[model samples]
Target: MKLLLRRPQQSDIQALHQFFFHVIQDTYAKEGIAELVDDQQHEWELKKKYVAMDLESRGEKRFFWLAVDEESNKIIGTIECGEANEIIQQTIKEDLSYCPEIGTVFVHPDYQNRGIATLLVQKILTTLEKQKKSSFCLDSGYKQAQIIWQKKFGQPDFILEHFWGTNNHHMIWKRALPFQL
Candidate 1:
């Protein structure tokens, strides 16, 4: 399938929400937490916020990119980034080593294992490069959603216990931009 990315728009909201739902469901199922939660409600709330932001904000510090399949014109995956070097520094009370933190990345099941996520990550890297940011950090719940990031990138910077403020463990990885000659 042909792959390309663009900033998310109003029309893609529904499909983006649907992709988010499926990814979360699949991830939870992989972690054996499906018995504990069905997160459609959370998805609805998130969708509302996303839509509002799409309407109200210009996404200055935050960048959201969606991967589109050329044939179907469908959004298969997304990368949400936050410009929070200072805020992240305050939260954990440490030096911020990375620029934008990868807020969320969810690829549809039909698009999984096709390197769509990697392509999206590369797009995000390109965006960061334009912003003159050298590296980015991403973290995920152990719910099988993180395997790809860990597999493709280096080992995580660290892991926190019950990081979701629940039983979930969070692992954070740093992806560095390739050196330009």
Candidate 2:
């Protein structure tokens, strides 16, 4: 499918939020944690705030890239690179406030496994490379996503065993810039 990758506008907030909700819901269901409605709501709110910050600050606070289906003009995926999230900061136990953390990677259920997310991440990495960033961090708690990240990023720098609960772990990766795509 043809996709138009671009930074979102103020007018895109409503649609973006809905897109996020759908993706988050699908993700929770796939992870077998759909019953955790509160957690889902929290994640949705956080994503909304991230996009709002990107729009309000004009990408100064958090840079975002959206993948809009060219034919439908609907947002199918999203990715961003910005300040370290709370989980990353707490796990690393250091002041990485100024560091760029690549996250918020969400691809619509219909668009998953189609290389949309990989393209978005590449765009962010290219932009960061131009900015002369040395590295970026990424962390995931979802088992499905963890598998993909592990394949692409190799071993994680840190793994919080049972971080989420029994048999569930949170893995974090800090990769240098100019990485092979």
lDDT of 2 by residue, 1-181 (tens): 7899999999999999999999999999999999999999999999999999998998889999999999999999999989997888888887675468998899999999999989998999998898888888999999999999998899999999999999899999988888876
Off by over 4 Å in 2: none
Model 2 residue 67 lDDT score: 96
TM-score of 2: 0.97
Task: Report backbone clashes per prediction.
Answer: 0, 0
Kindly report which residue pairs in candidate 1 clash with one another: none
> Taking the tens digit of each residue's C-alpha lDDT, what string does model 1 give over 130-179?
87877777666664666666677756676777876686777776556652
lDDT against the true structure, per candidate, is 0.69, 0.92
Alpha-carbon RMSD to native, per candidate: 3.6, 1.0
